[model samples]
Target: MKKQELIHLHGLLAQVQNHYEEETGNDVEHDEYASVSVRPTSIHMSKDDHKDAVFALAAGITSELADEATEQVPAAAD
Candidate 1:
Protein backbone atom coordinates (compact mmCIF):
# COMPACT_ATOMS: atom_id res chain seq x y z
CA MET A 1 0.00 0.00 0.00
CA LYS A 2 1.05 3.62 -0.54
CA LYS A 3 2.29 5.73 2.38
CA GLN A 4 -0.79 7.93 2.50
CA GLU A 5 -3.13 4.97 2.17
CA LEU A 6 -1.36 3.14 4.93
CA ILE A 7 -1.60 6.13 7.21
CA HIS A 8 -5.26 6.72 6.49
CA LEU A 9 -6.16 3.06 7.01
CA HIS A 10 -4.17 2.92 10.22
CA GLY A 11 -6.03 5.90 11.64
CA LEU A 12 -9.45 4.54 10.72
CA LEU A 13 -8.65 1.09 12.02
CA ALA A 14 -7.34 2.58 15.21
CA GLN A 15 -10.60 4.40 15.66
CA VAL A 16 -12.57 1.20 15.16
CA GLN A 17 -10.39 -0.74 17.56
CA ASN A 18 -10.50 1.95 20.20
CA HIS A 19 -14.25 2.15 19.99
CA TYR A 20 -14.62 -1.61 20.21
CA GLU A 21 -12.27 -1.81 23.14
CA GLU A 22 -14.30 0.80 24.94
CA GLU A 23 -17.64 -0.81 24.19
CA THR A 24 -16.87 -4.53 24.59
CA GLY A 25 -13.88 -4.24 26.90
CA ASN A 26 -12.23 -7.01 24.92
CA ASP A 27 -9.41 -7.46 22.39
CA VAL A 28 -11.82 -6.65 19.53
CA GLU A 29 -9.66 -8.22 16.89
CA HIS A 30 -11.06 -8.80 13.43
CA ASP A 31 -10.97 -12.38 12.22
CA GLU A 32 -9.25 -13.50 9.02
CA TYR A 33 -12.51 -13.12 7.12
CA ALA A 34 -13.14 -9.61 8.40
CA SER A 35 -13.72 -6.90 5.83
CA VAL A 36 -11.78 -4.07 7.48
CA SER A 37 -8.98 -4.77 9.88
CA VAL A 38 -6.46 -2.72 11.84
CA ARG A 39 -3.83 -5.39 11.36
CA PRO A 40 -2.14 -6.28 8.06
CA THR A 41 -3.23 -9.18 5.90
CA SER A 42 -2.44 -11.31 2.86
CA ILE A 43 -4.88 -10.72 0.02
CA HIS A 44 -5.48 -9.09 -3.36
CA MET A 45 -6.61 -5.47 -3.85
CA SER A 46 -10.16 -6.22 -4.96
CA LYS A 47 -10.58 -8.93 -2.38
CA ASP A 48 -9.56 -6.73 0.47
CA ASP A 49 -11.55 -3.75 -0.79
CA HIS A 50 -14.63 -5.89 -1.32
CA LYS A 51 -14.33 -6.98 2.28
CA ASP A 52 -14.26 -3.39 3.57
CA ALA A 53 -15.46 -0.15 2.07
CA VAL A 54 -13.80 1.90 4.78
CA PHE A 55 -10.51 0.42 3.71
CA ALA A 56 -11.32 1.11 0.09
CA LEU A 57 -12.26 4.73 0.79
CA ALA A 58 -9.05 5.37 2.68
CA ALA A 59 -7.01 3.79 -0.08
CA GLY A 60 -8.85 5.78 -2.72
CA ILE A 61 -8.31 9.05 -0.87
CA THR A 62 -4.61 8.35 -0.50
CA SER A 63 -4.35 7.44 -4.19
CA GLU A 64 -5.99 10.74 -5.07
CA LEU A 65 -3.42 12.55 -2.95
CA ALA A 66 -0.59 10.70 -4.66
CA ASP A 67 -1.93 11.59 -8.08
CA GLU A 68 -2.27 15.22 -7.05
CA ALA A 69 1.29 15.24 -5.78
CA THR A 70 2.61 14.05 -9.14
CA GLU A 71 0.72 16.83 -10.90
CA GLN A 72 1.97 19.44 -8.45
CA VAL A 73 5.66 19.08 -9.43
CA PRO A 74 7.15 22.11 -11.20
CA ALA A 75 8.79 21.84 -14.64
CA ALA A 76 12.56 22.39 -14.94
CA ALA A 77 12.34 24.69 -18.00
CA ASP A 78 11.39 28.35 -17.50
Candidate 2:
Protein backbone atom coordinates (compact mmCIF):
# COMPACT_ATOMS: atom_id res chain seq x y z
CA MET A 1 0.00 0.00 0.00
CA LYS A 2 1.03 3.55 -0.57
CA LYS A 3 2.23 5.75 2.24
CA GLN A 4 -0.91 7.84 2.08
CA GLU A 5 -3.04 4.73 2.34
CA LEU A 6 -1.03 3.49 5.28
CA ILE A 7 -1.41 6.81 7.00
CA HIS A 8 -5.13 6.73 6.43
CA LEU A 9 -5.31 3.22 7.88
CA HIS A 10 -3.32 4.36 10.88
CA GLY A 11 -5.80 7.17 11.45
CA LEU A 12 -8.71 4.75 11.16
CA LEU A 13 -7.15 2.38 13.65
CA ALA A 14 -6.62 5.20 16.09
CA GLN A 15 -10.27 6.06 15.81
CA VAL A 16 -11.20 2.44 16.37
CA GLN A 17 -9.07 2.32 19.47
CA ASN A 18 -10.74 5.43 20.82
CA HIS A 19 -14.21 4.11 20.06
CA TYR A 20 -13.49 0.75 21.65
CA GLU A 21 -12.08 2.30 24.76
CA GLU A 22 -14.94 4.71 25.11
CA GLU A 23 -17.54 1.99 24.65
CA THR A 24 -15.85 -0.68 26.79
CA GLY A 25 -14.31 1.60 29.41
CA ASN A 26 -11.02 -0.16 28.80
CA ASP A 27 -7.76 1.00 27.35
CA VAL A 28 -5.91 -0.52 24.44
CA GLU A 29 -2.37 -1.03 25.61
CA HIS A 30 -0.39 0.14 22.65
CA ASP A 31 3.00 0.56 24.29
CA GLU A 32 4.82 -0.65 21.21
CA TYR A 33 2.95 1.78 19.06
CA ALA A 34 3.60 4.57 21.49
CA SER A 35 7.26 3.72 21.53
CA VAL A 36 7.31 4.05 17.76
CA SER A 37 6.36 7.70 18.21
CA VAL A 38 4.60 7.82 14.90
CA ARG A 39 1.08 9.18 14.55
CA PRO A 40 -1.05 9.15 11.43
CA THR A 41 -0.49 12.87 11.09
CA SER A 42 3.24 12.39 11.22
CA ILE A 43 3.48 12.79 7.51
CA HIS A 44 7.07 13.88 7.82
CA MET A 45 7.94 10.39 8.97
CA SER A 46 9.00 7.69 6.56
CA LYS A 47 6.65 5.13 5.06
CA ASP A 48 8.48 2.37 6.92
CA ASP A 49 7.96 4.18 10.19
CA HIS A 50 4.26 4.50 9.55
CA LYS A 51 4.19 0.83 8.58
CA ASP A 52 5.80 -0.19 11.83
CA ALA A 53 3.43 1.99 13.83
CA VAL A 54 0.48 0.53 11.98
CA PHE A 55 1.61 -3.03 12.72
CA ALA A 56 2.15 -2.30 16.37
CA LEU A 57 -1.16 -0.49 16.74
CA ALA A 58 -3.04 -3.26 14.94
CA ALA A 59 -1.40 -5.95 17.05
CA GLY A 60 -2.26 -4.17 20.27
CA ILE A 61 -5.88 -3.59 19.34
CA THR A 62 -6.44 -7.12 18.04
CA SER A 63 -4.69 -8.75 20.95
CA GLU A 64 -6.85 -6.95 23.47
CA LEU A 65 -10.04 -7.78 21.59
CA ALA A 66 -8.97 -11.40 21.17
CA ASP A 67 -8.51 -11.76 24.90
CA GLU A 68 -12.04 -10.55 25.43
CA ALA A 69 -13.29 -13.14 22.94
CA THR A 70 -12.00 -16.12 24.91
CA GLU A 71 -15.55 -17.18 25.68
CA GLN A 72 -17.47 -18.41 22.71
CA VAL A 73 -20.88 -16.88 22.17
CA PRO A 74 -23.68 -19.08 20.92
CA ALA A 75 -24.70 -18.58 17.32
CA ALA A 76 -28.40 -17.85 17.24
CA ALA A 77 -30.85 -16.42 14.81
CA ASP A 78 -31.75 -12.88 15.54
Q: Which segments of model 2 are wrong by more than 4 Å?
A: 71-78
For all predictions, the C-alpha RMSD in Å is: 13.9, 3.1
lDDT by residue for model 2 (1-78), tens: 999999999999999999999999989997899999999999999999999999999999999999889968889998
Looking at candidate 1, the ten consecutive residues that score lowest on lDDT are 38-47
Instruction: Please give the distance, in angstroms, between residue 76's alpha carbon in candidate 2 and its true position after superposition.
Output: 16
* Weakest ten-residue segment in model 2 by summed lDDT: 65-74
Give the TM-scores of the predictions, in the order they appear: 0.34, 0.88
- The list of candidate 1 runs beyond 4 A from truth reads 29-78
Residue 39: error of model 1 in Å?
Answer: 11
Q: Could you tell me the lDDT of residue 41 within candidate 2?
A: 93
- Clashing pairs counted in every model: 0, 0
* Structure candidate 1, residue pairs in collision: none
Of the candidates shown, which would achieve the greatest lDDT relative to the real structure?
2
Residue-wise C-alpha lDDT for candidate 1, range 1-78, written one tens digit per residue: 664465556556556656655775655434432544324332334434533645554454455446556876666986
TM-score for predicted model 1 compared with the true structure: 0.34
Pairs that collide in candidate 2 are none
